[model samples]
Target: MPRLSLALSLLAVLVPAAYAQEAAPATSPKITVDPRAIVDSMPQQGTLLTGLYATQATIELCSVEAGEPATTAMNAHRRQLESEMRMDDATSAAAYAAIKGDVEKAGVDCAEGSKDRQQTAEVIAIYSGAGATPAQPASPMDPAAPAPSATPADPAAPATPATPAQ
Candidate 1:
């Protein structure tokens, strides 16, 4: 029937228009990180990644197989971790020792994060240097414009209104 066809046509046009209006997000979602999750996951060392990468970095100098003295290696490892984790020397040493023990006990080179790492609270927010925010909805008065191309625009083309002779 004509009524059915008209209703279908109206729905097709209306639904798309409604979706287009809400397509843009108002704000970007902030980064959320769970400490336990980060410790459990393994990250490939010497790899490059952008944004808030949830990767683990461990210092295994405390292992007996290393040719260095136990205290010496531990101190060096603690120092490295302190700088990396932005923690004090004592806290960093404790954190490193905690992980080192876990790895050694398992007779393996890697281990997951342990509960002894008291430094990690239940949840934490991590901010990566690479900034990425969700696209915001365009204003009704002014529509959004596409990014400019790499090639320069024509010099003669006037972007703004021509200034009257003063």
Candidate 2:
């Protein structure tokens, strides 16, 4: 009877210990996130043009580090944006230079398992074909109709141009 009780006690302790060992979560590798780095990497301006330029710069940096998948995704995104807002060669170059400079200043590092690298992958995934729908081009205006005001109702306000039909 004593042996039976001892055996039961051992089993109770061992079973719970074994279960606890199995239930414990595995430790994951530490990931450091820098808020300043994240902020620095972001687009300086809220304009669509700035966003497009930032995307291009991100692609350029990620392509070299993250490889072909990044390149493919970024290129597709670039094409989509370009189809919407066609920029001339000089403008494109200038925009790229400015964006690239900001990115460089931000110290973007696309090394494997890095925060920036993960962010780049996420950007590629999100901005690639499936994520955002392109804006529909405005319909052609009837030339005979009176021309709409080029200036805003408030003279001090800047005029926002209608999106050109693609």
Candidate 3:
């Protein structure tokens, strides 16, 4: 019938318009990391990572803990971890390179923040050491000793950002 065809035609035209209207607003979803939280967390996590790598290295290098072959394998793994840590450090540096803009936008003062944030930020401030606050009187780590990268809790996981509180 003509009525049926008209109805179909009208629906065909309206459907696309309706879908376009339903689509989300164009502004990219705001990423809501509390820069202070990240700044706070990094120090504790970084220190733990450094300690773990140092222990592993010590155990590997010592003859008492492992046999020659075992030591070799451990050394190899330790090297791999160190390499990964270097990559992570680089990534962290890159991430923090942009920190000033992001942190200020995220509403944190780079100079004085929370105690936890300060602790974490101190490490970064040391890592950066480009006239950042609380200048490093000494290097954070010994030149001869290196640290390891952080391994994920679940390798298969794609980390999901947390939803902001309403």
**Winner by TM-score:** 2
lDDT of residue 115 for candidate 2: 67
Worst 10 residues of 2 by lDDT: 129-138
Candidate 1, position 102, lDDT: 56
lDDT tens per residue, model 1, 1-105? 999999999999999999987996678789989766746243332111200111122222322232234335334544554555556757645654665565456
RMSD of each: 21.1, 21.3, 22.2
- The C-alpha stretches of model 1 lying farther than 4 A from their native spots are 1-78, 108-166
Please give the CA lDDT of all the candidate structures: 0.43, 0.65, 0.50
TM-score of each: 0.24, 0.38, 0.21
Question: How much is 104 displaced in model 1, in angstroms?
Answer: 3.8
Most lDDT-accurate candidate: 2
**Which is better, 1 or 3, measured by TM-score?**
1
Q: In candidate 2, what are the lDDT values of residues 12-90, reduced to their tens digit?
A: 9899999998999989999999766735443333355566566567657767353456567656655555555566667
Name the regions of candidate 2 deviating beyond 4 angstroms: 1-49, 62-73, 76-86, 127-166
